[model samples]
Target: MKIFLTLLTSLFLFFSCSTDDDICTDGEGTPQVKIKFKTFATGKPRTLDSVFVAVDYGAGPVAVVQNTVATDSLMLPLRVEDVPFTDIYVATSSTGNLSQIRLNYTTTSEYVSPACGIRRLYTGLSATLQAPNPVLAVETAQNEIVNESKTHLFLLF
Candidate 1:
């Protein structure tokens, strides 16, 4: 035997040219894609095992888009199967990814000096805040404003 006919012709050409779960080509079949998950902030509607979707693809062979019901800001319904041509890089799993929700804040500015003689008159304030999840907007100068000897500096986001 020629090594058993060269191992049965290389296992019949590697099982007739590789493919599992049905694929007759010239017959057309496997092609399903439906990715839906949106809830970055109250767009309302999300559910994919708790909306932490992440797909730069490469996790294919999945199938279950809307298996019944699961969308209330928990977004998740990804079933991108065998791909004839699909390019997806979905997101929404950044509970703390984008630099922990991106935040850059700065503070420490006060120039209140309009008396120009006794050197005891001040009234200048500047505070800045950047966002991804930053919600700090405060302006205080009430009650004729003494600012209580001014000694409060907090930069939080």
Candidate 2:
């Protein structure tokens, strides 16, 4: 009976404790902002011509896309760290015709895991077109960055 009790206690202690190395770290980072493009005339999904994306409002213009071939959807990381808002620059042509979009959101710190630590969760998103461009309209598909499958914005071109 004494040996059985000692083994049971040891098992309980081992199972109840958690270490950073033992924590699951897969898919622990913040979700990226997703955008889908559509045509204004046809109202159907369409791809743009080598759209260039970057963070042009902060510190400097950090290039996110450098002449990306062609795509109807884009998945971009905001700041990676904790930030209240993000400014995204989208350029369609090589002539530097840029369209600036400002995304404002509220952030909350969340505990992911011991290995991943805390991550920022963005919510209550609001977007504003800072510059005039080919984008005719903007739509918000989802406000929070809870999942990467959710489309945060829809651009009509």
Candidate 3:
């Protein structure tokens, strides 16, 4: 009787400790949008000496990249909160020319794991280029950003 009680208690403890927390370690989250730079005249890939990217608000602007040198490609993060729309501003220099790009997408809750709960996944991606645009054109290579390898936009300047 003593041996049976001990075994039962051990099994119960093992099962109780093994919860969803152990299985949710591989939870995936939203990925950043990739942008590739190109020459407006040549239509080929080019590198910028420095570029600034940020989100602007009525009061001020939040900087994503400030005076950072980017070669060929850059990964820009999108807003993952409850908001469905994100507006990003990009500049070639610190006090040089700038442009604004608006990204509109739909968000859906995805079940990652019980421990991780849910994460927001964006789809139906679209972009709008605003005035004072320094870019020659914008091309969307990938509309859905599921991984880091995905290139969302190509900017020609």
Q: Which candidate is the best by lDDT?
A: 2
lDDT (10s digit) by residue, model 1, range 1-157? 9999999999998887644323333313211222233344453334544323232234542322223334432222212233322222222243432211111122222332222211111223222322333222212222111223332222122
Model 3 regions lying over 4 Å from their true place: 1-27, 56-60
- Which scores greater on TM-score, model 2 or model 3? 2
Report the lDDT tens digits of candidate 2 across residue range 10-109. Answer: 9999987877657656666777789999888887888987788888545888888876587788998887556778998888876677788888898887
**Model 3 scores what on Cα lDDT?**
0.76
- TM-score for model 3? 0.76
lDDT of 3 by residue, 56-120 (tens): 53335698788565567788777777677788788887887778887788877777765777777
As a whole number from 0 to 100, the lDDT of residue 109 in candidate 2 is 79
Error of 3 at 92 (Å): 1.2
Please give me the total number of clashing residue pairs in predicted model 2.
0
RMSD in order of candidates: 26.1, 4.5, 3.5
Summing lDDT over every window of 10 consecutive residues in candidate 2, give the lowest-scoring window: 20-29
